[model samples]
Target: GAGWPGLIEAYRDRVDIPDGARVVTLQEGNTPLVAAPHLSELTGCTVYLKVEGANPTGSFKDRGMTVAITHSLAEGSKAVICASTGNTSASAAAYAARAGLTSAVLVPQGKIALGKLAQAVVHGAKILQVQGNFDDCLELARKTAAEHPVTLVNSVNPVRLEGQKTASFEICDVLGRAPDVHCLPVGNAGNITAYWKGYTEYHGDGLVEQLPRMFGFQAAGAAPLVHGHPVAEPETVATAIRVGSPASWENAVKAKDASGGLFSAVTDEEILSAYRTLASREGVFVEPASASSVAGLLATAADGRLPTGSTVVCTVTGNGLKDPDTALAGMVEVEPLPVDPGAVASALELR
Candidate 1:
């Protein structure tokens, strides 16, 4: 009640919501722009992390879900649907529950992380395990929505981008100007597209004097943007970003071209390395897909593509807790310690 209003209320004038529409929200915006001193030192740039994991649904999807569900409710829709690898389903399920609408999520069979699947199930969403990839699931959802009375809440919906653009506004608002470079994982490519729109709108409004170069990263196994074509079978450890055909392909490419940025693919090993670095070195635990941003930053900086002393912001898109399977991977197995302080100290090597 006495905290940060939701994004729509915070940027009511900027966002395009129908007049008199009842806003559906869960206080999903105003995520922290955390300083990354370790990343800064390593890259020789002023680095910050836009921690979207702090959102209501433990991912950036909540930002868009709010708007999509709100619009669905206003249009008198009793149900919402989407296709997701993980995060979008969780967010849509939650927002739909809040809006008192039935939610249906189409996901690839046996592909989604359990934590995210648990969220959708717990939120009462009808989970359909499609025997296909993410792109196929999306196509099915689109067709179903087109045939039925259900509203599709995917990034293909325009209102979703409107809500997502607020992240860029928050970054600019906190820093008092745009960063020199903004890096983020590009899955369906909606985020990069939305962020580019936000940054350009701010520049047009004279809110900031300059625009940042948009750096979009993808998992090497699923990098259609880098390959200049879609892959038939995308494979990656980072399930959240294992999408071969991005829905916002054209806009994402336009964003990169307009901002003079580049798209590169990071291997799963590189992604995991950055993931561990964020957790162990920087005390910021994020999902593996989120680490693609930091991995890209490190790759670019090491190759001298990122200039020293530049200001950079990397968006970590989802919470590590969203993928417990990946988090527990390679966990050390140890014998049960005796119930004594000495045993703990011995394990910690502090004695």
Candidate 2:
């Protein structure tokens, strides 16, 4: 009840932790599951936002990072390594710092959001600017971890998914049952894969009556899943999801197929529009990649694909503050008010 004991303690009985292991945490889970009145009205479905941006590091990656870093410490690891577009590195760096371990984050040069980069730096992570993209960084990090003693904490690590699956548990526990549909952004595809695993596990264990369809959306410029192949040079305004070749490709496809969901692409224009709308209308400010879920949901609803009156949850994966430049890119209209009540009233149309 007091701060919720973090996800590891909250779901200790459900997840595995090394015997007598030192726990590293920041109380990352238990994010708000808020109702979206405007989104529901627009889609004709009962819409909700699993606001993962409310996490300690302002992103869902913190959920997995705690467990990954815990395991890294228990395994006698002195350092942790990962390749991240932004959120993952921040999460990893924070957790590793809490655990008193060294962290190295490999990022694609000149492609990361400024806010995310600042998080990594403040958390004491050594940032490596690689010449290639996310996929290349992941490859390099994996290789480095394998050749050295540094532990890799990326989603490729089984423990990362094990930790991420807890999000599904929180959703089901809050709703008293699974929803008809669950939507999220797909980058390296780990989030979708983890959600599917979580839902399926809960269903098998009889925790819920049914599992929801998993809808995954990728940016059009980096929609390798939709293209059915890897794009050597992926490009997108949503840098958090600018992945060319997803490491969890097979599992993501399995999740889509098994859950009777589909993967699709949305353009940057559509993503930004949804991002702005979620902020301006729904009062939910999330990163551009996170808005992809909402974009896909609205698109499918307009196409008569999403059933009316059904329950739907869209996971807003990261905070908009993580990429403020995009939000502040265009001109913002502001009417200057004089130092007078009358002037303020006139500006507010109260006069």
Candidate 3:
């Protein structure tokens, strides 16, 4: 709401949002733009974290689902369906429950994180584990939505991208200007597209002096952008981004080229290392996929691609709690000790 029209107004003409859709918000936007001293020191750039993990569902997907579900409800739809890697299903299920509408989510079998799967189940979504990858599941979901009365809530639904663009607006409002570069992890690639659109619109309207370069990163094993082709069997330890084909692939490409940005892939090892660094050094614990942004930024900085003192923001899209398994990986377990205060104090590193 900073020097701009209402959230709904920004996308009313650009996207095919439902007519007369009533807003039922959980105050989703306006997330903190926190300065990252550790990242800044590492990159020699002014680094900030757009912490989307603070969203209602512990992920940025909440922003999109709110609009998608609201529009679906307005259109007289009693049920909605989606294919998700993980976070999208969780958000859709929770929002559908809040709206008192039936929701169904198709996910790649055994690929989703435990937390997300639990959320979908607890939110009462009809969860289907398709014996295929996310792309296959998406195809099934699209066919199902077309054949049935259920509305599809994926990023392809336009309303989702409209809502997600608010993140960019929030960043601009907090910084009072667009940063030199915006880095984010890419899964279905919708988030990057929305961010680019938001920045371009803000610049076009004379709200900002210049647009930031849009840098998008994908997990190395799941990176279609870097590969220059779709990977039918995309794999990554970052389960949330284990996507083969991105729905907004062309849009993502356009965003990168139009902004003079780069689309690259970070290895699983690099992603995990960045995650640990964010948690231990930066005090920001995010999901492994979310760490890809920081990973990309560090990589670019080391390669001298990022200019010193440039303002940069990395979008950490999800909370570390979403994938607890990664947090436990390589962690040492402490054995039970006698019920002695001195023993406990010694174990806890008392002087």
Candidate 4:
């Protein structure tokens, strides 16, 4: 069971991190595992949200990026590169800036959210807009990284998974054991694999009494796992998860089978509903893809698969501010009124 101490020591000794990498003080793990009584009440289970939005780059990608960039620096690479829907690029840009390395991000043209794009730009990445989708960009990045001096800092690198496994350790620490079930949205599917690895290692080492069932949800339009093949053209409003072919496909399948987990697809409508529910009810404003976990949980609960009073942990992987446009969809614009007290009282419905 390589929980905190063992995992940290293992990462330091086994992983290929730089000897003296400069990491941001705020760039470590230990994100909040907040209780969501509202969601718990609805599901008849004690539901907890692993709020990864609190990560330094506003997504769980920082966990992986820190390790990936550190390894890149250790290898003496002057530049790092990645293909991202949004979060990965932002993380890479920030970490590269911290490590004093140039970052280059390839993104699908007109696909990424404004805030994510802004983060990459502000962090000084050379952002390239590919004419095709995320898969296309990823392919180009892989080829470019292979042919050039820039290090590929994507989830394809094993070090990223090693770093991301820390989330599982943190969850076990807070809950005192593995929850009955763990759910999360899967894009490239590396996160689920990492969680499974963490949980298995922890259980093997006697840190946890048992392993939790992993549940991975993907956007219906972009679900290669459920569909049993990659989509030629993946589409979803949850831009962060509109992946056609996940790079870590085999490892994700291994996680599902090893943990007795389920892989499912949720519709766009369901994703949006969960997004609003997390925002208004649970008071957790996460990006649409992050809501996919809640969507799966609600669906599984409705199907009577989840037991009452069981502990369920859902990983909300990113912050809502990364995609503010989704939050404003179908909303009416309000006109500003005069700055008078009378106007304020009138707007407040005071007679």
All candidates: CA RMSD in angstroms?
0.8, 1.5, 2.7, 3.2
Clashes of each: 0, 0, 0, 1
Pairs in clash, predicted candidate 1: none
Residue-level lDDT tens digits of model 2 in 1-351: 365889999999877989999889899899999999999999999999999999999999998998999999999999999999999999999999999999999999999998999999999999999999999999999999999989999999989998899999999999999999999999999999999999999999999999899999999999999999998999999999999999999999999999999998999999999999999999999999999999999999998878899899999999999997898899778977778999888777996
- For model 3, the stretches where C-alpha displacement exceeds 4 angstroms are 1-19, 349-351
**TM-score: which candidate is best?**
1
Q: What is the per-residue lDDT of model 1 for residues 154-240, given as tens digits with 9 covering 90 to 100?
A: 999999999999999999999999999999999999999999999999999999999999999999999999999998999999999
Instruction: Give the TM-scores of the predictions, in the order they appear.
Output: 0.99, 0.96, 0.95, 0.94
- What ordering of candidates by TM-score runs from best to worst? 1, 2, 3, 4
Tens-digit per-residue lDDT, 1-351, candidate 3: 244343455445544566577754555666778899989998899999999998878899888887888898888899999999889999999989988899999999988888899999999999999999999989999999999999999999988988898888888878899999999999899999999988988888888999999999999999988889999899999988888899999999999999999998899999999999999998999999999999999998998877888999999999899998889988888899999999999989995
Q: Scored by Cα lDDT, where does model 2 land?
A: 0.94
Query: Which regions of candidate 1 fall more than 4 Å away from where they truly are?
Result: none
- Relative to the true structure, how large is the alpha-carbon lDDT of every model? 0.96, 0.94, 0.89, 0.89
Q: Judged by lDDT against the true structure, how good is candidate 1?
A: 0.96
Q: Candidate 2: how many backbone clashes?
A: 0
